[model samples]
Target: MVGTAARALIVSERRITGLSQVVIADLVAELGPVWQARRDAELCDRPRRRAVGAGAKYKLVFVDRLLATLVHLRHGITHDVLACWFGVDRSTITRAIGEIRPLLAGRGCRIAPGLRLRTLADVIAHLGATGQTGIIDATEIRVRRPAAHRRGRNRFVSGKSRTNAMKALVVTDDRGRLLFCGEVRAGSVADITQARDAGLVDLLADTVHLEILADAGYQGLAAQTYGQVVTPPRKRRGKNLEQVQWLMAHHEQARFEHSSRRIPVEHGIAHLKNWRALARHHGHRHHLPDTIRAVAGLLSDQQATHKRKLAALPTGQSR
Candidate 1:
């Protein structure tokens, strides 16, 4: 019965993932210039003597191929599968992706340049009436155990995957724009500990009352920074008046507003999941960090373009 139930859940995951991919593809399309710019490095880095196509005849639209790769990635498909679908070798797919990532950043996607994603207020304003506070937290990815891996460490597991792996601390703003991501760490790392180590708390503290909202994983961060936290109520032996108010939903209106504020982060994650590079990272020792930097950088570029387009749309059409 347990095995049967797990299969059902897996099927459901596959069923709904199509919606996620469509959303991801549309999002990637907005950053056409970003991908086109990387064509040279991506094609040149290939181990082959001949290009996929010469000049414009056999050329693939960087954006379309990128979208194709994203759809294939949604299922944790292998590079072999990706190569077959895209008519390239597994290594070619990998190299093309890697070479194109950094350019996606630094060029059109410089989020605050010297600083991490711009101020929380700036993010909120861009999200507009649909958003309120900045939500910050880390998300994890799963990987197969290393061959040399052994022992009771098997007790450490993730709900995301059946294999062994670690986590990356993702600090995102209210709209789900990834502001920062920490170095990969063991999944066992505590949220608070990772948050601090990743410098999210420091960023929040730099501003006064900017309202850093997160799940309960962020203990005392809200009060310490004079920001508001929106985690669900925690079950503890005791509670003080100050803490109680923070726990209360206040009213139906407050509840709706709270839900809206956190929507971006969740939606953003859904969007990121479309890129296989971010979702099922095999942690290709060499490609891991650079992949994260490129993909995250590309996602950020797409995000800014999304905001810009919405701002240009008639107010009635934007929502």
Candidate 2:
């Protein structure tokens, strides 16, 4: 049963991983060596009494392990379900994901060969170098409510979504390609607070030419970044009726233009949420950061592949 399902799914890679066969093959080729080295290092550090190959081998091979992890991340399948699919115990599926997930997260968001943006600094530098305008936004993912006795339980409740959730800041290029997905925060954390805590102001301060387009949630950032952070215009209060009406007209136009520029970030967030694991995290809250970043990295890889194919197409041919 496991063999049949696995073979069928492998033939149709997009169903499981939301990635093409070519992309999966490229990932396996690139990540296999690094995973092997890391495993070797772990074995050496522990100095197992049994020689190499003395213990029972993995029930799922490296490729299967990677595939299983991707499927779980993309679809949020339970470990027991994955175990049934792969013909292994639930513990095996759990261990496999624990191992492979970090590798994906560590890869960050790859834009080109030998260029991966892992941190906010890396994203800032890339945008500056490429002269691409970036769009920034925060999105929330609903999660299981915390127990009454839990410390900081209220922190998980979002004022905006009015649900127990976690939030992450997403940054994307002008064309809606993911550049960075910030660390996860409590749902109660304000978008502006998260941006400031992530050092967006300090980082963008040095990059004179790079501008970040954001929505109204990041209002104060424009002043702090010296106009580098562009946001929708705010209406002036306590003005005469004539003055207020004029300001309102001006603000409406400015807002429309700002929203158009900032729309890419919404698309970026939508793409990130397409991963079931991110749609609503059922796992421990502490693990959400790794899960979100890993999903972002995989999505970025898929986007990069699509872009390359488009570039390769003949003139006027659209995919």
What are the per-residue Cα lDDT tens digits for candidate 1 across 147-227? 555664653365445455566655466557776543556566667766666555555554544465676677666565565
**Which candidate has the top score in TM-score?**
2
Q: What lDDT does each candidate get?
A: 0.54, 0.88
> Ten consecutive residues with minimal summed lDDT in candidate 2?
1-10
lDDT of 2 by residue, 1-319 (tens): 2575665577476876899887898889988998889887887787578876578776787788888889999999999998988888999888889989899999899899778999989999989998999888899999999988989899989999899999998989999999999678899999999999999989987888678888888999988999999887777774698988888888889888878887788888988889999999999887889999999999999999988889999999868
Tell me how candidate 2 scores on lDDT: 0.88
Clashing pairs in 1: none
True-structure lDDT of candidate 1: 0.54
Cα-based TM-score, every candidate = 0.57, 0.95
